[model samples]
Target: MIRDILYTLDSPYRAPLEITGFRFGKGEKTVAIVGAIRGNEVQQLYICSQLISKLRALEAKGAITSDNEILVVPSACPYSMNIGKRFWAVDNTDINRMFPGYDRGETTQRIADGLFQHVRGYSYGIQFASFYMPGDFIPHVRMMETGFQSTSLANLFGLPYVLVRHPRPYDTTTLNYNWQMNQTNAFSVYTNQTDRIDEVSAKQAVDAVLRFLSRIGVVRYHCHNGFLASVIDEDQLYSITAPDGGIYRGICHPGDEVTRGDLLGEILDPYTGDVRAPVVSPTEGIVFFGYAQPLVMEHAILYRIIRRLHG
Candidate 1:
């Protein structure tokens, strides 16, 4: 394994900020995996570190195939990570929203530019991504429906779900969308948690990546055939929102099955502890995501369910 700084910038108050990458095997630029663009994405970072560890063992044993290379970048924004901030510490900007970025633009843009330069042109690009909201997701492989997206390729990861999302205006600036536009097969792997490490899901993610690599002949690792992924469009999800701002009390979690009108959660008055609203399922389906935080605002999305289809 070869460890190198992928990009670096001078810091006025402290040490230079560096984005590091670990390279395994030699030859073709087969795959690039990124993790933790946001500081709070502890799970994403953990998954990448575990991937690096596993790749190191595979490389040491000559398990990595010749003529194929894999790059694992564990963290891109360590400065924010150091302070436990979610975005850039100085400007409160998101590195993820500055992709395919401008070299002469703001700090996050510059960092994105430098990093994208190094990661682009790979056969595949995989990002361990977190949700925009505080929630838990059923582990899935998500792709942007950028015309270049291939659900068949996404299924190789073997995750339980393959979500194809339609890109909005702001999505054009994201790493996954830009990678797809640039001819790279890009995928975003979402595990259950963002801020905290979930070992079970992390192992599932690592094994899924290994399974993909082995299936593509990049490595010789053996792993079980994961789920035959259920391909779902992002629009198909049923979103349940909080009716009033209050303390949230959720009874169901991601991956739970619920029937129509089932009690998913309830909102209580922050001071009085009286029930403010009861959140219920509108359709029989699997919980794809559930808000994990204890407090919520009115109209805040509480759950996203994958509505079951009848025969």
Candidate 2:
């Protein structure tokens, strides 16, 4: 099927937001995948568009078919996307934070309302993007404690790691939280940092989704080798912070693997160029993330060591 442009929200003051997607096959297992709810996440939009294109090609060749509908909204916030910002033009509110939105609310709220309304009928939902957190990413799925279905889907996504997050009561209005709360199942998969997007991370994400859809019978392509069956809890994370305030330098880049007590970085006295103290790894693990900037504060996170034993 040729992909369709469902609706375009025009802005006389700026460029319009285009909601584009494709639907294929027919059955009870409808799925909705959205990306770039935050405007600045162009990488996610591009990657989701790529996925959409590939799925369309496969569907046309009869190489792919879904038991249920698959709806993909590749770029959700066009105005923010056009401006390369993360918030709506009207109030600068985060659309993701204002989910299950009211129809008569602000512009972004209206957009959220529309998305929530559209996705509610689906059996499963996924929101993909790069996050605002610092440093390189280790692919992970974030879920609310909705039920076993959320857990199963998170495992099925096959990311290198999984984060089983609890939806803080305050976060109950978020897309995933609200959907899960209302008996609809949804999960979020993402890389770290909205500002930096890498090809490796993007490819990993697409691979994860390919496997997920395959398992769900959304497509026929399957690669069992890519799945990472373990789920990582918040406790598994260990942070290595700077001991003193100084000009900081990291010994390893994000995504590098290391053993316990490995040298992570160092702090230097800015004026004298003297070594302040070395920041050592807290545990044997991969440097999943860290601060990229050269400056530091006492207790600033110089590196995030996700214990190797967990992997």
Candidate 3:
């Protein structure tokens, strides 16, 4: 196992932000796995750490294929993580949104640029990503509809679901989208937690990546057969929003199957202790995301259901 610094940013008031990567085997850059671009993504970083340990063991056993190199970057924004901030500490900007970045641009952009310079040409790229909102959900592999995405390729991860998201204008600047634009097949892997750690889903994520590496001939590790994976479009999810800001109680959790008109959750008036709104399922399907936080705001997304496909 070889450890190297992929990028660095000096700080006068704090330790230099160092993006470090671990390399296993030698030759072609077959795959690159990144984690924790945002500070709050503790689960993502933990998953990558577990993966690195697994890879180190595999490397010791000569399990990695010859002429195949894999890079694992555990975290990209350590400064924010140190301070428990979600974005760049200085500017409050997202590194992910800068993408194929500019060296002469802002701090986050330069960090993005420096990182991208080192990771771009790999055959496959995997990012352990977190959701924009805080919630617990079924683990899935997500891909951008960048005209270069392949559900078949994504299924190799063997996760339960594959989400193909249509890119909005802002998505053009994201790492996953830009990676595809540069002819590299990239995927974002989401586990069940973010700020907190869940052992089951973390192991599941590590196993999924190992499965993919084995399938792609990069490693000799044998793993359990994961799901065949159901593909869903991002726009097709049935979203349930909170009717009013209040204390929330979700009866249904992620991966739970619900029937149409089922009372999935309820919102209570914090002051009156009365049920103010009952969130219901409109269609029969699995809950992809379930509200986990105790509080909710009016019109905030509470649930996103994946409707079952017909024969």
- lDDT by residue (1-311, candidate 1, tens digit) is 99999999999898999999999998999999999999999999999999999999999999999999899999999999999999999989999999998899988999999899989999999999998888889999999999999999999999999999999998999999999999999999999988899999999999999999998899998888999999999999999999999999999999999999999999999999999899988899999999989999998999999999899
- For model 3, state the Cα shift of residue 267 in Å: 0.1
Decoy 3 TM-score against native: 0.98
Task: Write the residue-wise lDDT of candidate 2 on 118-225 in tens digits.
Answer: 777787888885544445556678776656345766788877767776556766767888777667778787765464566777777777877888887778875765
Question: Predictions ranked by lDDT, top down?
Answer: 1, 3, 2
Q: Which window of ten consecutive residues has the lowest lDDT sum in model 2?
A: 129-138
lDDT for 163 in candidate 3 is 97
| Candidate 3 residue-wise lDDT at 110 | 96
Off by over 4 Å in 1: none
Tens digit of per-residue lDDT, candidate 3, span 125-189: 99999878878878999999988999999999999999999999888988899899988899999
Which residues of candidate 3, in runs, are more than 4 Å off?
309-311
Model 2 stretches astray by more than 4 angstroms:
2-12, 27-29, 244-247, 253-255, 269-273, 297-299, 308-311
TM-score of each: 0.98, 0.86, 0.98
lDDT of model 1 at position 311: 96
At residue 286, give the lDDT of candidate 1. Answer: 98
Go through the candidates in order and give each one's C-alpha lDDT: 0.94, 0.74, 0.93
